[model samples]
Target chain A: MDTISDTLGRFGGVYLLPLALGAVAFILMGAPSSWVTLTIAGLAMGMMVFLMASGLSLVFGLMDVLNFGHSAFISFGAFVAASILAGLSGWLEGGWFLASAALALALLGSIAFGLAAGLFFETVIIRPVYRDHLRQILITMGALIVSEQLILAIWGGTPFTVARPTFLEGAWIIGDVSIEIYRVFAFVLGLSVFVGLMLLLNRTRIGLLIRAGVENREMVESLGFKINRLFIGVFMLGSALAALGGAMWAGYETLITPALGGEMMIVVFIVVIIGGLGSIEGTLLGAIIVGLTANYVGFLAPKLALASNMILMMAILMWRPSGLKPAVK
Target chain B: MNVLLSIRDMKTSIGQYHVLHGVTFDVREGGVFVLLGRNGAGKTTTLRSIMGLWQPSPASITFKGQNIAGMTTADIARLGIAYVPENMGIFGGLTVQENLILATTKGRFDQIRLRRIYELFPALEQFWSKQAWALSGGQKQMLAVARAIIEPRDLILVDEPTKGLAPSIVAAMGEAFREIALTTTILLVEQNFNFARSLGRDMAVIDDGHVVHRGTMADFAADSDLQGKLLGLSA
Candidate 1:
C-alpha cells in the first residue's frame, strides 16, 4: 500500500494526470468505435496546435514581444495552399500527380512567403518598436489587420475547398473502428515536423546561438554573432513553421478562409500561456491537452466546446501562476 | 606598454539617461587595467561602451588604431574582444560543455585549449554535464570566465566578477584573471577594492562617468584621500 501510494505521489501529477483524463475522454465519447481512432484524432489536432503554438511561444520567450499577427501567417499559408491546389485543375487534368506537384509548389511558395514576411516584419516594423511595448502592440496589430485584409482581397470572402488527394481518401479500419487517412497524414506531417524541429534545435550551431539568445540577447550579440541576422533567421523560421501548419490544415479541413486565422488567434494564445512560456515540451503537452479536451467536449456537449478550453486554461493558471513547467531559474 | 583599446571622450545615454559623460581611458596591451567606482558611477557603462554594447557618440573611440565608435557589438567582438556582462549571463538551460561548444566559432574544437581552461579551473570539468543554473554562484562565475578565455580574444571586458560571490571564489577568480592577463589585455570593472588592489596593475577611478584618477594600484593604495574622494568609501 505504501509503495502504491509512493508511485502515485511520484508520477501521478506529472503527465500521467493528463494522460488519464485524455484516456477517459476517449473511452466515453469515441467508445463504439475503437478508442484508438479518437486517440489518433486527438493526437493529430494536438500536434497541429503544437506546431502553431511552438513558434509563437519561442518568439515570446526570446523577444518578450507579443506577436498578435502570428495567426495571419497560419491563415495565409492555408489560403495559399487552397488557392494553388484549386487552381491546378485549370492547368493540369489528373488528380494524384497534379495534386502531388501542386502540394510541393504550395509548400515552397508558403515558406518563401512566410520568410519574406518575417524578414520584413523584423526590419521594417519590429526592430524599431523593440523599445516600446505599446508601439509594438499598435504596429503589429496594424500589420495583422493589413494581412487579414490582404487575405480577403486575394482569396475573397468565400470559403475555399482544399481537396484531399486520392491516395489519402477513405478510412483505415482497425478492429471495429475506422480512421480517416487525411487526419493520420496530418498527424504524421505534424509529428515529423516536430521531430525535425527538435533535431534542428538540438544538433546545430545556429540552434545553440538561438538558445543563448533566449537567455540573454545582449550576451549573444556581444559573443561575435550578428544580432540582426540571428533575429531575422529566427523570425523567418518561426513564420515558415506557422505557414506550414496553415497549409496542412487547409488540406486537412478542405476549406480555407481569411477569418480562420482571426478565430484561431485566441486558442493559440491560450495554448502558449498554459504550456509554460518558452518551453517546447510544455507547448506540445498543453496543445494536446487542449485539443483533446475541446474535441471530446465538442463531441459530448457541442455547446461547451469553446468554454471547455477556456475553463481548462483558467484552472491551470489559477493553480500554477508560472505555468506547468516554468522557466528554469 | 602599447595601447590596444582607447576610449576618448566617450559619451553614452541609456534611453535619454546620460550615464557616461565623456569618459576616456586607454587599455594598454597585455596589462590588467581595472576601472574602480561605487555603484551607479558608470564603470560598467564604460566597459559596455568599449565592447560596443552601447553606441557612444561617434568620433570618440578607437581600437588597435582604427575607429570603432559606431560599430555594433558583434562587429567589435569579431575584432578579438569579448565581454562578460554585469550578471554572469550564463545560459541557464545549456550544459557547461554545450556552452563551451557554442563559444567556439573557429571550427577547431581545440582539445588543448579546453584542457588549458580546465587546468586553470578544474571545477569546470566536474560540472561539464550539469546545466549552468544548477551550479553554485562560484561555478557559474568560473564558467563565464572559462567561456571568454577558451576562445581567443585580443582583449576581454569583465564587469564585477567578485560581486555576489564567496571570498574564497573571489580569491580564486583573482588568481585566474592574473593568469589570463598574461595572454590577453583585460579591462575590468570592479567594486571590491581589495580584489582590485591584489591584481597589481594600473587603476582608473571613474566617478560620475569621468576618469578622475589614473595610476598604479600601489599609488592609489598609498593615497587614502584620493580613494575616499573617488570611491566615497574608506579602504
Candidate 2:
C-alpha cells in the first residue's frame, strides 16, 4: 500500500492536470455540474484521433508511405457528411430509429466517399510515387492542394451544420456533474469502432495477411499475396476511418467545414509520431495522450492546443528517434 | 516429366544497375534443383524474377505448362509456386501456429501434418506460442520451410536455407528437406556446397548474373576444380 501510494504520488500530478482542467472547463464553460460531460467530450475527441491515427500509423509504419494527403480524405468525408445533412434539412430528428438510420447512411456514405477518394489518390497520384520518398511528397502535396480546392468548390469555405437527434440533444445531470448526451453517444460510437477495428486486425485471416504486409510487403507479395490489392484495401480502410472521424467531428461541433480536417491532420500526425508508427495499441495510447494534452493545455490557453502536440512529438522524438515504438522489424 | 517452372533468358534491372542479365534455369518435376553461386551473383534475383517480385525481361516462363513470366507475384504464387527468400522471411509478429494457419489459405487445416512438421523440428513445437521474432535462426528457417510446405504447391523456391545456421540445425534442416523432397519439387539457391551436394539431384552454378555450369550434383562434386573455378571454394 505504501509503494502504491508512493507511485501514485509521483504520477499523481500528471493525472490531475487533465482532471483539474476538465473541472475548470465544466465550470467556466457554464456546462452545469456534469463532470461526465467533459469526460465524454475527451473520450469523443480521443476516439476521433484513434480513427485518424490508426490509418496514418499503419500506412506510415508498414508500407513506409508518408501520406501527406491523408487530411484531404478527412476533409472530403466531412464535406460529404455535411452535404448529406444539408440535404436532410427536414428529416434528421424524426425519431431514434430514423435518426440512427440517417447517421448510418451518413457513416456508410462517408466510407464510400472515402473509398472512391482513396482509390483515385492511390491509383493516379500515389502509385507512380511508390518507393520514391521525394516524389511521394511532391505528388501528394499536389493532391492535397487539388482536394482542398475541390472541397472548397463543392462545399465552399463556409461551415455547415448538421442536426442532432432530439434524443441526443439534451443533458443528464448526476449530482455535481451534468453530461451531454451527444458526447456520450459519440464516445460509445468511437470506442465501438475502435474495438471493431482491433478485432478485424487481430482476429481475422486477412488481418494476419495485413500484418504480414506491414512487416515485409515484398515478401508478402513473393509469398503469393497480391500486394497491390493489399495496398488498395489498406488505403481504402485508412481513408474510411479518417472519414468516419470527420463525420463524428461534424456531429460533435454540430458544424462541418473543409477547414476542420486540415486542422485535425496536424494533430493526427503528432499522435502517429508520438505513439509510434504501425502499432495499433500505440496509436490508441498516443491518441488519448494527445487528446488529454490538448484539453489540458487548451484550458490554460486555447491556442496552446496546437503547440503542445508539436512539443510533445518533439520531446518523444528527441528521447526516441523512431517514435515511442521502434519500427524495426 | 512435366516442367514445373522454367526461366528463359530472363533479365532484371533495379535502378539502372542490372541484377539479372539474361539468366535462365529449369526445374523438372519432383527433385531438389540447386542454384549455386558466389555472393552477388544474381542467384536470389533469379528466384525473385520467377516469383514476379522483379520484372523479368520478357521471356517464356511457363509454370505447369502455362506462360507466367511478367505476372504479378501474388498471382504467380496462387498458381502454386512458393518462394522462401534469402533472409528467412517469416512474419515476426505472428506465432508458429498463426504463421502456419495464415499460410494454409485453402482452409485445409492439417493438424497431423503440422504435428509431423513439429516432429521434424521439436524446438518449433516447444516455441509454438512464442512470436516468431524471438526464434533462433535455425527455428526461423524451420518455420519458413514449414510455412512453405504447409499449403500444397507445385513448386517451392528456397533461397539459402543453411546460411548462418548451426551445424546440428543444418543437419536437422537437411533431413527435413529430404523428407519434403520425397513428395515435392524444390528449387534451392545455396552457397553451402556440402549441403547442396548432399541433396544430390542437379546443380546450376551462377556467376555474375549468368548460369556458368549446369550438370548433375554428383558430377560437380566429383570435379573439385570446376567447383573451385565457379564457387571459389570446394567442399
Candidate 3:
C-alpha cells in the first residue's frame, strides 16, 4: 500500500486526477473528435466554475464564514451582465473590437455590482455573524432567498434570453470536431484569471497576508494586521470573481433564470469542497476534474450527470478527508 | 528596571468558564521575566490577555505607559508587543521566509535585525524557502521565535516555547532567549524550573489565575521550599 501511494505521490498524486479521469474516459468512448469536443466544453465549464468557487473557498477558509449567499453574487452578476449585453446589442453585432468592448463592459458591469454588493453584504449581512457558522449559514441562506425573490420581482420568473456578441457567436468546425468560439474564449479567460490569481497570491504582499490569514487569522492579527479589514477586501474580491463567473456562465448558456445561481450553487460548492477550502491551486484542480468528469459522465451515462460530482467529491474525501490540497494550519 | 507592562486585576473568561481571575504582574523593561506556574495555572491565559487575544479585560492592563486593555489584538500588537503562543502559532502553509516577512511592517526587514535572526537560528537560514510545516519541531519553534524578533519590538510574550523540545534544543532556545533579552524584554511563561532559573531576572508564580509570589529569580531559585510548594519542584 505504501509503495503504491509512494509511486502515485511521485507522479503528482491527486493533481493528476483530471488527466487520469480523462485517460479512462478516452478509452471508454473511442472517438477522438467527440472526445476533443467534450474535453473543450468541460474545460470551459470548469473555468467558469472556478471563478465562482475560488472566492467562496477563501472567504470560508479565512473568515470562517459559511456564506450560502455567495451564489447570490453570481446570480446578480449574471443578471446585471445580461442586462448590459442586451443594452449593448448594437456594439456586440459590429466588428471584433466593438464586440469585445461590449463583452468587456458587461463583465465590468458585473464586477462593479459585485464590489458594491459585496461591501454591502459584508457590512450589513456578514459582519454581524462572524465566527458563528450556524448564523452565517442561516443568514447567508436567507439572503440568497431574498436575492432570488428580488431577481424574480425585477426580471420576473421567466427565462431571460442572453445576447451573445457576434464575435463569440459561432463555432469553428475542424473536420468532425465542432468547437464553440465562446468555449475557447471561456477557457482562455479562465486560464488568464487563474494565472493572474496565482501571481496575486504568490507574488504580492496582500497575497502573503491572505495565505497566512487562511492558516490562522488570530496569528495574522497578532502580527499587527487587522485581519477583519483584510477580510473585507477578500470578500469584495471573491464577490467580484463570482460575479465575473456569473456573467461568463450567462453567456455560456445564452439563457438564464432567477434560479440560475441556485442551480449553479451546488456545482460551485462541489468544486470548492473537492479543491479544499482556502486553497486556490486545489480549487482549480478540483474544478477541472469536476468539469471533465461532469462532461464525460453526461455523454456516457446521462442518468449520472447530476450525481457525478457528488460521487467524485465522496471518493476524494474518503481518500483525503481534508480535500485535495488543504491549507496547512 | 522600569516596568514595560503592568497588569492590574486582569481577568479572562472563555464561554462561561473564567480562566484568569484577577491575575496581576509586571513585566519590567529588559531581561526575561518568567511566569512560573504548574499545569492549568492560567499562565497561558494571562499572556493571551496581555496580547488582547481574549476579551473580558478587568481593571487595567497597561503597556508602555498606555492603557491597552479592551483594545483589539491588532491594535495591541501594533504597540510593539509580539506574542508566541503555546502552540508556536506560526502559519504552517507559508514558507519560512514568508512567515518572517509577514511579521515585518510592509514586508520590509531591517538588514541588521534580519542578520541577527539568521545568526541566532542558522537552521532558519538553511530552510529559508521551505514551508514552515515542513520544519522539524525545533525548527518550527525557532521560526516562531524568529518571527517575534524579526523586527525589534519592545516586549515579547512567549508561552511555553520550550514545551516539547529535547534538552539540546531547549538549551539552544535558552541561549537564544538570553541573547534576545539583551535588546527586547521577554515575558516567558515557563514550567521548566532550571530553564527559568538560568535566564529569568524577575519572576512570578501563579497558582490558579492569581500571582501568588513575585520577586527576583535569584531569590526564587534560592528557595527550594518555595519552588517545591509553588511549582512542585525540588532543588
Best by TM-score: 3
Alpha carbon lDDT of residue A249, candidate 3? 98
Using TM-score as the measure, name the better of candidate 1 and candidate 2: 1
What's the true lDDT of residue A11 in model 3? 92
Clash pairs for candidate 2: A33-A176, A33-A177, A33-A178, A34-A177, A34-A178, A35-A177
Estimate every model's Cα lDDT from 0 to 1: 0.81, 0.80, 0.92
Q: In terms of TM-score, how similar is model 2 to the real structure?
A: 0.89
- Each candidate structure's TM-score, on Cα atoms with residue i matched to residue i, is 0.93, 0.89, 0.98
* lDDT at position A157, candidate 2: 78
Per-residue CA lDDT of model 3 for B1-235, tens digit only, reads: 7889998988889889888888888888999999988899898888888888888475479899999988999999999999999898889988999999999997788989888888999999999999989999999999999999998899999998888899999999999999999999999998888899999999999988889999999998998899889888766
Taking the tens digit of each residue's C-alpha lDDT, what string does model 1 give over B8-68? 8989999989998888877789868899988888988888888888879898988999898
Q: Per-residue CA lDDT of candidate 1, range A192-311, in tens? A: 877877787778788777777777888888878886787788888878878877887777778667888778778888888988877676787788888778777777788998799899
What would the TM-score be for candidate 3 when compared with the true structure?
A: 0.98
Q: Put down candidate 2 lDDT per residue, B58-90, tens digits, no spaces.
A: 755888878888789889888888878889888
C-alpha lDDT of residue B132 in model 1? 92
The count of backbone overlaps in candidate 3 is: 0
Better of 1 and 3 by DockQ: 3
Q: Return the candidate ranking by lDDT, descending.
A: 3, 1, 2
DockQ of 3: 0.84
Sorted by DockQ, highest first, which candidate order results? 3, 1, 2
In model 2, how large is the Cα lDDT of residue A136? 87
